[model samples]
Target: MPEFPHDDTTTNPFAAEPQDRLDANPRRAIVTGADSGIGRATAVALAAAGVDVALTWHSDETGAQETADEVRTHGARAVVARLDVTDIPACGDVVDGLIDELGGLDVFVNNAGAGLQTPFLDVALDEWNRVLDTDLTGPFVCLQRAARAMVAAGRGGRLIAVTSVHEHQPMVGASAYDAAKHGLGGLMKNLALELGHHGISAVSVAPGEIATPMTGQTDTDPRTEDRPGIPLGRPGDAREVAALIAFLASPEAAYISGASVVIDGGMLQMGPQAGAAVDTHDWRTL
Candidate 1:
């Protein structure tokens, strides 16, 4: 088994102590960016919990199909679609497409995002736009579509988003990412307030460093040795984050809304991790 950051037996302070809150096990959800990384894990976890999943992919149809197959192996129907979150206008159509295919949408997880790590000084306008459009506006588009569907169905629904630890804290060289996530956090909160009367809830799950392809960094990398800063003394696993999303999407988490659950192993609370030491003897100016 591949060891993950949070694979240890030690307890996590951020997660709900008793996961019994989600015992009802609601089925049927749409997970955006479900082709790989944390999104794929969430889709699989939901399937394991008996949730039929509509898994969306952007540039990887094959990857999306693979996730769908996994979902089916878990005994839950899996619907796959190629969805580009940045295509703002088509977002509504995507939701309707999922609902039409899956029969109905009870839970919506906005997990599609693009990470931009350009320095603030060198960050271009287009980069900022791209990050904001995907991380913030994209979710809003899905939220609007999902909210309408939930209201029409006359049943309360769950609207969840996967933000980043930067949603609340700041990180150097991540200006675009930080701003977008921060905006997304605020967006979810506002949606929660507006939709609460209609029995709909919106929330965000912010993850820290996870052993995902996006980071391009591994546990063994000496640069990651400062994991001690995180109370858990390591990064988190994709599955661990998925578990939380599954719980929130279920009927049991109905009372939780407008909340941003930080799953960074207490890293955010402890402040930024120390910058890795680097050797700089030979240098060239570009």
Candidate 2:
């Protein structure tokens, strides 16, 4: 038998102290795409949790200001900024600026994403790249910046990505969207693994058919709507999704990293059953 080398310096991984420990209560957060929809809801939710928020928007400055107002109602500091994630590396700079304005960052929520409904065969190179840049590349840059800030501060943090149900299941006419979400979900898992040593948690919140502007259901009451395919009989509300995000951002979720939490109304569970029960081929088109 070969003699094993003595390794007196080896220590139990579980016994090692994290490079940075999470704050007992997170104090500041950033929510991108807070102009409206899920991002807006998440911003307000964090504020209600007594966390100061920095809100970023792409097109709707008015909407972002509205979200900031709501955040202020919770007695939390709210700062607004314009951020177009598709702008590439510049977006990462915007994140850094916001982190600075907030004094520090305890959480960063990547909620800005776009999808194209064009068929895969008809998708132009520009369109595909646009979607990918917005949904994946840009987010990766910003999240990386946020992670660096957290590491430098030596105070653990949370990184939340608002992915889609498409992250787990592909959709018709959503090739680029599906690919980006899948990549984002994978990225979050990797971040969780790499950042855990620093006490930072990374998670993905996947929503399905939410009543948001992205779904053309802004201001719509999901409870009043009916969805025959979903077991819950309706689409989800942004607030519901936000609530889940808020929980994940909390210290209570320190051990729940490297996970994609789905907030669909039992939609994923109906996959095979719905496929078998469909009475028409209309689903083939967007």
Candidate 3:
């Protein structure tokens, strides 16, 4: 696991922008993988901005409930659901059910993802399938269902996916993950073109080295985390990433679609060569 703070929810002092920053809308959303990390923070931020949020968790019901509880503190209705994004047949049902529960859906954040850290030559077929299924195929199904819902409702909507820096750059020992991310980026582009006529906008937010449970860090203060490789010299707070998502979900971003906005503390600016030349850390085992 990556090193993260235990009380991470409080780490980022810049978590919530003024509620007025959000353009008014249905104020309803569904966030997948809301049990932790970027998903949880996005949910909380949306709720704070008066968006009723329905959150889904794969295994961590406790974490899901905790997130929901925080959402409610903002006076927004929060629902908890069980979801496995890779479960294709269930995607439509789950998405529709959440929309029904929320009265309607205005935003869908595809944040649930799986990754592989094996060398390209060593990656087994099963591992490859799992990464593609969860990272690429899952978002495809979810986006389709969500876009259809938004279209049928005749109300404009927001579709945001939490991609990674890998979406734009390759990483050592992450062949499967990189391929899946690239596919996801392409999918979002297609969705924007396909859904724009229906008043729906599709976009992807790419982040690098976020402090989350998946990285073996939970609730840790990123400000104190010494990360020499990152231009900011520290890991990004999950809430910081969430703040960006909240902004994109706002009606202010209506004109923005098919964009892959990166929030990596300028990490991508450092190419693979710079990584080898500057950071002594080996990324292969990551």
| Cα distance off (Å), candidate 3, residue 70 | 0.5
Candidate 3 wrong stretches, greater than 4 Å: 1-24, 272-286
Best by TM-score: 2
Collision pairs in model 2: none
Local accuracy of candidate 2 as per-residue lDDT tens digits, 24-88? 68999999999999999999999999999999999999999999999999999999999999998
Rank order by lDDT, top first?
2, 3, 1
User: Considering summed lDDT, which 10 consecutive residues are worst modelled in model 2?
Assistant: 14-23
TM-score of each: 0.83, 0.94, 0.88
From the highest TM-score down, the ranking of the candidates is 2, 3, 1
Question: How far in Å is the alpha carbon of 135 misplaced in model 1?
Answer: 0.6
Decide which is better by TM-score, 1 or 2: 2
Displacement of the residue 107 alpha carbon in candidate 3, Å: 0.4
Off by over 4 Å in 2: 1-20
Tally clashes: model 1.
0
**Each model's backbone clash number:** 0, 0, 12
